[model samples]
Target: MMKKWLIVIVFSLVALFLAACSDDGDKASGGKSDGDTVNLDFWVFGSTGYQELVDEYMEENPNVKITINEGEMNDMHNNLFTSISAGSGAPDIAQIEVSQVEKFLQAKDQFHNLNDYGAEDVAENFLDWKWAQAQTVDGEFQIGLPTDIGPTTMFYRIDVIEAAGLPTDREELAAEIDTWEAYYEAAKKVKEETGKYMTDTPQLVYNAIRDQQDLQYFNEDDELIMEDTVKEAYDFTTKMIEEDLIGQNELWTPEWGTAMAEGTYATMPGAPGWMVANVKGNAPDASGNWDIASIPEGAGNWGGSFLTVPKESEYPQEAYDFISWLTAPEQQLRSFEIAGLFPSTPDVYENEEFLATTDEYFNGAPTAQIFAEAAKSVKTVYMGVNYAIVDTEISTALVNVAVDGADPQAEWDAAIERITSQLERQ
Candidate 1:
């Protein structure tokens, strides 16, 4: 009787242990077990004001944990490349700049196709062009979700314009400078009257004109095309430089910030929505003196980013869920308010609250409405994998001509040669 009782006790203990093991296995596989947890790591460059949103997300999702790692733009992108090449240590989520997207899409297999996670159902949530940027050429696989878009506009100092004897009203100024030629005339007047440069740099002018086109350095076939349109921009930028209508300050430099604060430049044309925050941050004391107008000859894009999940992510589904939620219309609007990241989600463009928003930093300009309109008007352009490399060479040539008085034609030819060489190597 004692032996039988012991045998029953041992069997019962084994059953309990097996049940506990099964529950643990279920939690490990991301089942709806009460104790299941999903941890995600996010890598981003620059501030997008995601911390607060993540806090709210965590509050609503007690079983999920998220950590954000912020790094410089170039550093972050380089690290992402290294991690992907190493086949480990990649972040669950990464914010890739618009220019870098094409490069990464070349190795699409490294990223998880978000389509597997119901990406198509939410496809309509973002702009068609934006949504397409992260998809395969055949439109089968998708790797990222759209985030912010940089809709180009002219950010100017109202006081400086008034000093130049130009229209101060946004609508009036916009109409007055409707075309690039009209803009150049205004710049001449501004320089003549205020003795301040009308634009930041020759490269900026070139970038604005280049961005206005539906076609850029490359065509849909990923073939290089250096057409007359690009040369026109280059020639026009050199003309501005020869006329001394642009400043010598390089962007992202301390000298540039000082020049902006001191009203050394009257206008910053072809700037994007995010530049509003940069302007305010760099020139805090220049508050209430600035305003925005539409970019000359319609809107162009400057900078934007998308959030992607790598295949190495242990929790791709959870990462996608968080990103999809984070970029939803409501959350995008909130991010805009917090970080001046213009929404890529068109649904927010018509929101009454968004349209009504104004900024005293820009002299009560209806900033949201202006940027929204520009964002909507932006023409989609094809930037191939080597767009950044080619663009860098061209901009470097422009800088050389602007700063060191390099011969324009020679520099242009050299830039082309350098771009050709790089592309050949690639």
Candidate 2:
């Protein structure tokens, strides 16, 4: 009877030890069962060709698999907000546009503090302003890495400018139109001589000028700052219309497409990607006639995105590795060479291959070098959460001023009211 009791006691002890081990393993794996493969979901705004780039990285590492979920810009923003609020199956990695950083940074704890993973060294390679956009109010670094940058340039048709008796070469045009005042003068000359407006619409001109500003729409305390900047943008655009330098057309409509295709506009200030798809898609026949130059201002950036790791990710280290690799200087250079997406890495600007390359689409002009020079001079600004709302209201106000002959000061006041109201709700 004594031996039988000892055997039973030993068996019970063994069972308890096994249960403890199982519980510990569950905690370690974030409730995932043993022997299960770890899958990471990555979300991007659109088909940005990151899958092909990531596939090459995965081929050497079989332990990790990445699944990309692509959606429209607005849809992706909504999805991120919903998933984050629910504390549910959010993506391990997500792309956040520069303009939306303020919104996401508000929930600072929802994202992994990237500084803990030695991302600070990588952050040093980017421009000061670009890197600052990823940090929270308390100075906690939240985002992963910046993949591409928006260094705006004036992409023009060499043939069109030549026909208008304007400077056709990049250097001459850059020199002639060094300031916004000079740019307006050139626009008037182009319109009067060739009957082609310098831009597609008043909003386009306003957007370009607004990008050149240090403060837009709002102040440091998030109060509406539209009175001065919006007034300036509206007055400038309205003057362009009054001076017959801007063509009257709706943006993104069939009429706009027709105008671009038929050379109704001579120049457009936009990012490098616009040259690849939007402009090229609209006017494929005018390929070799196009070229890129620095914008009226020395430097300005428009749109770009950063990859971030969410706090709920099961595999934070893996996500960080992938995000860092994707935004590394070497990888960004490859992306620029393949997709015409400009590199955010300052070191990539020194690359001889990037600086020397010429595009056949732009009459073999060395556009890479031109953009690289412009990217260096770009000044960064703090874009707040209600940037979109303010942008929309201001655009509407500008349209009224430019197209409807509305009073510029009155439109500016009205825009201030609307933008301030919208931002206050946020």
What's the lDDT for residue 172 in model 1? Answer: 93
Q: Assess each prediction's global lDDT (C-alpha) against the native.
A: 0.87, 0.78
C-alpha TM-scores of all predictions? 0.92, 0.91
Give one digit per residue, the lDDT tens place, for model 2 in 1-426: 999999999999999999899877765544445555557899998547787787887786666788998999888978897888889868999999888888888776788888877688777787777777778645566565787877778888787789888888888988888888988888878887888888878877788788777888666677667657656877888888777788777677787778777887788865444355677777788778887887887667777889998888877777888888888988888888666678888898899888898878777878778777777777767777778898887778777866787876787778878877766676
Residue runs of model 2 more than 4 Å from their true location after superposition = 1-36, 403-405
Give candidate 2's whole-model lDDT: 0.78
Across 1-426, the per-residue lDDT of candidate 1 in tens digits comes to 999999999999999999899877654443445676778899999988899999999999999989999999999999998899899989989999999998888878898888988799889998887787778778898878899998888988898899999999989999999999998999999989998888877767888889899888999898888857898999988988888999877778898888888888777888888888779878999998889988789988888899999878877778889999999999999999888788999999889989999989898999889988887777778789889998999989998988998999999999999999999999
User: Residue 196 CA error for candidate 2 (Å)?
Assistant: 2.2
